[model samples]
Target: MPRPQKVRKILCPPAMSGFSPYGIPATDSEPIIMTFEEFESIKLVNYEKMPQEEAALLMQISRPTFTRIYNRALNIIGIAFVEARSIQIEGGNCEFEREWFRCTRCFKLIEGLENHSKCTDCPHFEKNELTRLNPDIKDRIA
Candidate 1:
């Protein structure tokens, strides 16, 4: 049996939701979906200029797994650049490493730390359990 996919940890959501090629009819082709994990891998390896092993550790992934993910990201990016295809980065098996939470009732991702740590969208927010904020979080940063 295949192992359950681990949720890759992302520091933050992408600033831009997606990218598309100009001068082409939107209906001419469908946008390719790049997983959010792939985007994070690209940011870690290329944008951050971090070593693969170190980046892997930060993402809580094995070095080999990180390499594979990095290679796939590069391939997809190459395809988009070469073909001028629209690139839509969306779904991935992932969890946020930053201050965010998925509300159980509404299944909405929300910023928890800065926003009072309760999901405003949830109907049963009074009952829904939130992930605890670190009391020493500020100290750790300093």
Candidate 2:
């Protein structure tokens, strides 16, 4: 009779216009595995100038949860910069509720839940995940 827990969506940095991807240097120090959802919380509230309440509502989380996520994200950013460490985004308890489509061939489940016209294991299926409905964003999180 218990309600199912809600899955938080990863909030990405506001669509940056003309921004290029840059890789941070990795170090011997352990990399922090901040989830995409937490990262989005910081970007929305801090960078996008959204109020905590508004951001929380948008994220479908309580205000306190949003605040905690935002703070954790900020801390990760600060540590990465101050320590000159590479930051790897990974390992969150969240689940993807998006329409997940199973590959008819390989039985691979696509996170976006959409069929990309081919199985992920197929040789010709590589157009880079973003273009495909089921992107492996988490696997490539670096």
Candidate 3:
């Protein structure tokens, strides 16, 4: 059986959100949902200055795939920044890790520090059990 494709992490804390200074507005009529995974690809390859092969491995994707994702991310972010339009993060092919929690009720995937031991999204989950499971978490410059 083929292994699952690991989705790269893209939820950058607001402080680290990659908003290019030269991003231009996207004029494409069909809207695209930019996944966080794609964002991480750009950060790893461009921002962190990692080699394409290394970045691809870190993100658990093939080098070509990583290149595609990174380019797409850069394109979207560039347009948003240049056009001054708000970028909305949405759906992608990925999964959350064990430490991460995606609230069933709210459908919010909370990414908190490991020390917190609780999701920032719905911290008061006394009724909802926090299942210990691993999800794909892409790293960024913290």
Candidate 4:
């Protein structure tokens, strides 16, 4: 049997779940699924202007693997743009370094529950509006 895949280390979750082209209905086309690792690869290399070798080290993956992931992310985004399809970020063999939460009202990412507070900028904000992004990885393993 093939060896099990290593879980990639993601620094944090994406602020938003997905994206779609303006003036196009989401139902018009099937969404492209971009994994968390793929997103990280793009963020590290493209967004952060990080070198491939350094980004690989940050993700605890090899440079070659990081390249492949980054390429895939670019392809997905290109297709999404050309086809006017939504890009959904989810589902990867990855583990986050910390718990993350999002304020539904303003879509602000919070590091942890202890740090979660009402989003002052959001009207009608409530503590209960904070949504946890990552479930405990240990729980999934067990």
Better structure of 3 and 4 per TM-score: 4
Candidate 2 wrongly placed segments (more than 4 Å): 1-6, 10-28, 95-111, 117-123, 126-142
Instruction: Kindly provide the TM-score of model 1 when superposed on the true structure, using C-alpha atoms.
Output: 0.68
lDDT tens digits, residue span 14-113, model 3: 2222233334444543344467676567667778999989987776678898888888988887776565665655445544333454445444444544
13 in model 4: Cα distance from truth in Å? 1.9
Candidate 3 regions off by >4 Å?
A: 1-32, 101-142
Clashing pairs in 4: none
Strongest candidate by TM-score? 4
Order by TM-score, highest first: 4, 1, 2, 3
Question: Model 1 clash pairs?
Answer: none
| lDDT for model 1 | 0.71
* TM-score of candidate 3 to 2 decimals: 0.52
Q: Candidate 3 — number of clashing residue pairs? A: 13
Error of 4 at 101 (Å): 1.0
The residue-by-residue lDDT of candidate 2 on 50-116, one tens digit each, is 9989988887778888888889888877876676655555435343446444444444545542455
Best by lDDT: 4
Count of backbone clashes for each model?
A: 0, 4, 13, 0
lDDT of 1 by residue, 1-142 (tens): 5666556667876655568888887777778888778888999878999999988888887888888888988888888878888888776666666665455555556665776457788755853455432222321211
Error of 3 at 32 (Å): 6.2
